[model samples]
Target chain A: MPAANGNNAGILKSGHDARLLSRSNKCGNTSGLAPGYVQTNLIVLPSRYASDFRLLCARNTVPCPLVAESATPGHWGKIKSHLLGIDGETLAKGLDIRRDAPKYNVYVDGKLHRQDCEDIVTEWTDDHVAFLIGCSFSFETALADAGLTPTHTARGRNVPMYRTTLPLCAAGVFRDSTYVVSMRSYPASEVERVRDITRPFASTHGEPVAWGWDALERLGIRDIDSPQWGDAPLAKIDGKPLSSFKNNEAEVPVFWGCGVTPQEAVMRANLEGVVMAHSPGHMILLDTLDVETIRKF
Target chain B: MPAANGNNAGILKSGHDARLLSRSNKCGNTSGLAPGYVQTNLIVLPSRYASDFRLLCARNTVPCPLVAESATPGHWGKIKSHLLGIDGETLAKGLDIRRDAPKYNVYVDGKLHRQDCEDIVTEWTDDHVAFLIGCSFSFETALADAGLTPTHTARGRNVPMYRTTLPLCAAGVFRDSTYVVSMRSYPASEVERVRDITRPFASTHGEPVAWGWDALERLGIRDIDSPQWGDAPLAKIDGKPLSSFKNNEAEVPVFWGCGVTPQEAVMRANLEGVVMAHSPGHMILLDTLDVETIRKF
Candidate 1:
């Protein structure tokens, strides 16, 4: 890891930059890197699960918006240039999926074998197919641009996440997956502004699934103080780990579809072979797709 | 048949109105009917083809945007309430699929056996499933609202359609299908405005697939005057079949995904069982979805 302070800040500008950092194994996590470009959540699975996973994303597009997928198993160098959104304009430039991401979480027989492995060169087999999903981080950049800065960003902590009771439309052997949402808090008065800015990025997470105090309850979230991952919700400090910085004011919690959803679904299925994903908060940046006008009308 | 003067011109106000007219065999077609509501293209097939058809629509979203589908074979009472778009809001109020559309085309072993059948109560079988698709006519109203009236609409003729060389992504049994586009002519100066107005209606064929003179040649449409369906291209005619309105000034032809695509594909498959479709111009109107902002971002 870099020092307690960010040693590699303001320099990571493109996919090549991030890929170089990860290839060197010097990058910690990929938050706040390549601010204006598109980043994807990666998932490499066996060929047997490809058809079911395709149907899964199609049936439940909101939470599991598919950007592109490999044309053939084990061929991680390219994707099918679907003419939807920016795939047609982007997929021409190709990169090695194994080393492009800052890190990879290898799951063996439905359990995480390792996290932050820099590259998956050895774990990759001839039957693996890579799927790159649209990330909420694309719209998060939009949120910061629109002046609704998320609380976690200001506090310098990762966005809080929770696995909710909101079930996904299942397909084939992947029949037991539910929705997982990333949370950002803003004042109650600015929820509409926050919604409008994010709703345009349809390929990304799009609009807030729910907001306000009752929002968590509606989604069957039990505790606000303790999130499943990331830092705690903004509140009176009672000796909690917030990485310093106080006087925070964001009050209304807004939830959007998390990119980790497909990751969770594939993990829960627990197929006999290997599955790969980008480490949470770490992403693979793309060359195309302007963050401001990704799906903006 | 209705008179040449349009006997039921202003009476089509809702799904209820169109259903009544078709039930009595009085409605000619459903264009310009129930002006503000959503209209759908209907397709019914054997249960054996449902899984493949679902995959086809999922892959080729541009030409085959799925609206809702039957819950069971021969049971069209309700659709899965996917919270995306308007399926959740509209599926509550249901209607009889057998009598909802203005006309049904019965396809027997890949050949059109009959057209303009009022109802298919006798043809209903437990093994048949229905699929409703989005139509481009929904955006036609948006164009007129933005003051870019279609040339064919002003001429008292159906929109011209042509079979293109643009191939659709094949799934299972739907291999030999190409795209069929519905045409509406506009001026060169107003093409951008026309695109801006219609692009947001994503479910309703979104925007024009191609435009300008070279567009027809790109799609392998050799003869501009000879369309496989609907009226001919807007031109100075010597003795062609068009209703009397001569000052037609709309010059440029714009193409959008025609609803007839799925019908043509299913017919080409040449399955052993019966296949059903809505007549090219006739449709079924729905109770929800405001066309002005289906996907206005």
Candidate 2:
């Protein structure tokens, strides 16, 4: 049982438990809320963009894995998911997506319209579709269990994210979107063990795509000290090839496909519709489907 | 030593060994010619499209892993490669790109201009950049050693390829590009073994992206009986959901990122520039690099 400290109950037993927590603590991060379930990043958009958005997840499976998507437009309550061959685990039948998540960030024409909304029930319409993307938090426990806890989590900070030179496979209207990767630094010796632990968790951004100092330069990331989102890694890089990091030169940076990749895509596309996403670190946890079952092998 | 049957030295000691054979046996497929070497797909285009094409490879790393790339506009001969951090293992010095490949397919304005050309010397220009992409053949020996030989290879046929509905992350001027996948069928029980063996070979198209019947519908591949290129798999299908196969229904379909993906992208982009590629199954093999050294882990 996870610490449902703010929950009416002492611990979370299911996805609804986290949603119940969300109702009271509307702006809290869902990082450690649900212990044995799926936590997902949310993207609710107009039906017209749904097809293209769905295609985006299909092509870029690592960054935008589909956990539970509405079978049709406006079926937010029943985001039926049958991913990686799990028999259609419906998320708490009639689990209204608009009010279930902890926080919402609404966008209009690709720019940030509003942030920290408790529920977007007023924003719901028959024309809008909701997509539930697998979140990296779902696999953090697995890493921690394997004694490979991420540096950010150990430091009690959000994982740093950077916009990469790598482009997302563009779907209809979602053109020219650069990939955003979340960064975590590990000891050089622990990097391979970290990758091996997370590779099977395909539902989440499975494995680190880039590692070490050279990879940042390769991915076109100009700086290691500054990041696009969250807290930066504890590193004092000098120049082109990162040789010095804090006092430990053995600290290597690892990057994984980020769920924010979709948000960045929607931001760039700037589509003419209300796009709703979860505030960073705030996510919707689903019941029945444990992260353990979401294996590639 | 691989069968450099037409080689003056009768064995392949370096990447140039295959090029020597390419000069005389201009139309032979380089599949089994250079064992223990990296075999690559060729893509030569005007320098203007090189940046976007590079981005395409960076974004879609699985389908288009970068083994070696032309650093400048016309450094085709000295294709300096430092991929996966091998400390710049340059291929055979002055290995002329124009006349080395076994066969070339030149496209003008995205239409097939010529086929089965011995050399593309006339097509070379100061503005052309040659991109050498990692090919799946670089790992076929690994698969074969693991006893997971692809059905097509065992039957002496080219691997079947299909244009998937999944779109490529569109780069500049390369809009609305769909992904193309190469298919191989295997016994259902051996699928996991196949994935484990190939997952580390990141230089080549690494693991199977999709497998089983459901994956076809998910990728929007309608017909399994007919493929866009190469020979169709040993399959028998009737409708939407594929359940039946050639007697042994235990045979499951496995798909990897095809080198043909770039060709499909170039074909769809239909740019106003000359484009060149190796014919299917024909590739350039490089020395000093083995498929084993190109591990992700």
Candidate 3:
């Protein structure tokens, strides 16, 4: 993560402050971190669950791309970057996963308990394995680059994530209910380019699976004024409500695969003890750039 | 391979004729059969060489992409296409590996001996493995789709291929050697788009490694008239010599990973007996389409 205090402020400061708050057990949610670097959702499990988890990732690669799996079981510290020449450095060095995350949630017997990162070190075992799944930071970056601001990012609030009726492919015990997606609204004309841009970033989520105003209604979302995750969009520009573009027409909404999908899978699997993950915004900054990773795909 | 000589005579007859020619030792080469479908280059090796060969493909996937590897050694008839759904039928069904090729060259103990496909199959043992690799037919399709005329295709000739000084990454017993590339030309303005278009088709040679007329001359070829593998361009179009549009405006000639590289590797390894490949152009027609395979990447 980039430094927050001195010359860097605003967006960059938020990342630094988040890291500091996370280190102090103050801010556990990573909705705000380094502005440019990617943030990933993490899943840690035992080797016994590794193969099944691998299968789950393979089956639902769009949602749970296995960006970097531990080279071997029990070595949570060694995350290999797929790009050659950069490996061996621990992701924990610059950002401590346990301390840097704003909040750490513990799942024991599939029940959730809020815990600080330091409290869970005793739970780390030789049998444990860690997986870093791609997150939506880049997608958000893409959206922002296209001049379509995500409401959550703009308001400094967590992006609203919802569990959908879409069922994920089951791999062993690691079965996830459909998908949990992040919604953003854009004008109809911009949807095609968004879809085109996101298509190459398949590991990140790929293209939008559904787009339209009625999508929220179809998903049984009743209230538009109050969101389950983040603040609702500010006033609509012009007469039309802010809509995600679909086929050159302004769509009422656009939905994309979210990082929470994998987290939900890990939770549903009901593994014993605890599973570790990066709290939302914080991520393992890879030595290789996004373009190189994209090229590998 | 699709059975020709039926109602789809215009296209089917040419395929049927090619197949018939294979039976009588008159097929010449399988280059132009069933024009639109993917054509493959073939490489056969003993099981002992399989792992090394697999590594060779992995290390230098561009030229020697392992489209299909025999499930188990010596089961030549059990081939499967990696990108395409084409199943492994006998290489001997419609075409004879030894005799069908317009020109069949054999190597024993690292020395060359020209022989027909049948002459080599007699030496086939359970230990032998066959590998089918992607070729340039798809790239040619891309060039045509881009509206750039490939001179060789328009003139009814094989695209000129050359053995260059570009060394391939070696694996195990396979030593590094300069690459062999097929060439077609387009004007300078079209080169960038051609590169952009073909870059996605990594399975079939992808982008060119070099460009410009002088680069070809630097590779020790004096006369453009004397092409190493196929006919020269028919004529200069709009002041530019009809060459590989695949090449960039940069001095380096665009070289894609050719399926022939692995064939050459297998020959260079010199395990024993005769190795069979698609009779140059007469490739096995796959159920998979080019666009579908591109989507996978």
Query: For residues A1-297, could you state the per-residue lDDT of candidate 1 as single tens digits?
Result: 332115464546675676666667777666667666677889998988887687667645667878777868887777764325545336426477888887889988998898878799999888999898878877766777777767666556667889986656445556547788888877677877887677666667666767776666666788766678766866323334322222233365678888888888898888778989999877777775545334421
TM-score of chain A of 1: 0.88
Q: Which structure among the candidates has the greatest lDDT? A: 2
Q: Considering lDDT, which of the candidate structures 1 and 2 is the better prediction for this target?
A: 2
What value does DockQ give for candidate 3?
A: 0.02
Candidates by lDDT, descending order: 2, 1, 3
Which CAPRI category fits model 1?
Answer: incorrect
TM-score of each: 0.53, 0.53, 0.48
Better of 1 and 3 by lDDT: 1
Better of 2 and 3 by TM-score: 2
**Scoring model 1 with DockQ, what do you get?**
0.02
Distance from true position, residue A56, model 1, in Å?
A: 0.9
State each candidate's chain A TM-score: 0.88, 0.88, 0.78
Q: Scored by CA lDDT, what does every candidate get?
A: 0.71, 0.72, 0.57
Candidate 2 per-residue lDDT, tens place, A1-297, comes to 424223334446677777767766543776667666788888898998876676567557778877777767877776667474554445555477888888899988777878988988888888888888887877787887887776666655667888987756445567567778888777778877877676666677776767766777656788877888877676322322223564353788888889999988988888997889888888887765566455532
Per-residue lDDT of candidate 3, residues A165-260 (tens digit): 555644456643566777766666776676656655555665565566666644545544445554454423442324323233443566777777
